[model samples]
Target: MTFSFEQPPDKLTWYHLGPLLDAEAGRLKYNPEQYTVHGVSNNAVACCWAGLLVDGDGGLVLTDLGRSMLASWKASPVGQRWLAEQAALDEEMSDPAAPSLPAPQPEPQRADQLGLFGAAS
Candidate 1:
């Protein structure tokens, strides 16, 4: 019925966009962009316009609607799938043991007969 900063959420809103997110964006912070989970980007401004967040003492805090949306997202099966996938992606991205992307190849500097130029010079 009530939300408290001290209590952990049912599902962390901050990490993988789930785990890390819960620790980062889910809490009240000194930064001004906590509401949108990122700094003053389009989504940040849009969230304010959408009434999902508002200016608080030091930064943006979630409005009632925002909290409800987060609650619903966490409760849904899609959210679970997305969270799991995101967590895996994050792990893969950071894992030194995971395969690294192929090194970029040098591109041709000149245009071809078809007038197509290489993606990079």
Candidate 2:
């Protein structure tokens, strides 16, 4: 089926994607039109149209477009924040000595400000 990425019904989130991701990653068998996320059921057609999945002789497979889209979503500001939080949790689980937080990213200076409190030069 054909679908456009210009505007999707939902903004993809990390939540409710475990099944689909697992299927794509080969962790689970693809069972076409038999997955749900956040109480909403997903079908192969919808996924294929969204570029998140493709139909193959075997079953369904994740496409490069889907992978890239997911990566892009995860790299967004909000996504980055989530990543930091997950990293913190993972650190706690794997090694207590590791830093609990990600390095702070400096905020961009306002156009009116120069260095610190100095006026724009």
Candidate 3:
């Protein structure tokens, strides 16, 4: 299974909650065709590992902890900020102007971001 968002925001895990909230609002569908059978299965299993959802007769069902946590988070300022940041990231991976490529003489390369998580690519 993959951690959809390898890096969480504000250490509050808004990425995980966003999906649960979507599920609560009936926007998240468990249709395997939409996200492949393994994708759907992997996501549900990952959510279960996060303790925010569980396997149900129909599909993955959000847990009580997930709901309560989302509610509590929304009531706090930090949580609000996190949500805003998450919204931005979800909206676009890159925005505004980007730096021009280095001149013919390039700079040293940086290590793979995923390397930090033991999943180098």
Q: Candidate 1, which ten residues in sequence have the lowest lDDT sum?
A: 15-24
Which is better, 1 or 3, measured by TM-score? 1
Which consecutive 10 residues in model 2 have the weakest lDDT in total?
36-45
Please name the candidate that would achieve the greatest lDDT relative to the true structure. 3
- Residue-level lDDT of model 2, residues 8-112, one tens digit each, is 435666442553465556654444455444122354446665667665555566677666666776778987887699788877889967666787865666533
Better of 1 and 3 by lDDT: 3
Lowest summed lDDT across 10 adjacent residues in model 3 is found at 1-10
lDDT (Cα) of model 1: 0.54
Q: lDDT values of the candidates? A: 0.54, 0.59, 0.60
The TM-scores, one per candidate, come to 0.54, 0.43, 0.47
The residue-by-residue lDDT of candidate 1 on 18-116, one tens digit each, is 222332374543443443544444444445555555656554567676667676786789888887998999988999988888988655653243356
1-121, model 3: which lDDT tens digit per residue? 3233332223336346656666667555567786775435454455566666655555566667656766777778987887798888866656556455666843345345435578545
Instruction: Kindly provide the TM-score of model 3 when superposed on the true structure, using C-alpha atoms.
Output: 0.47
Off by over 4 Å in 1: 1-39, 108-121
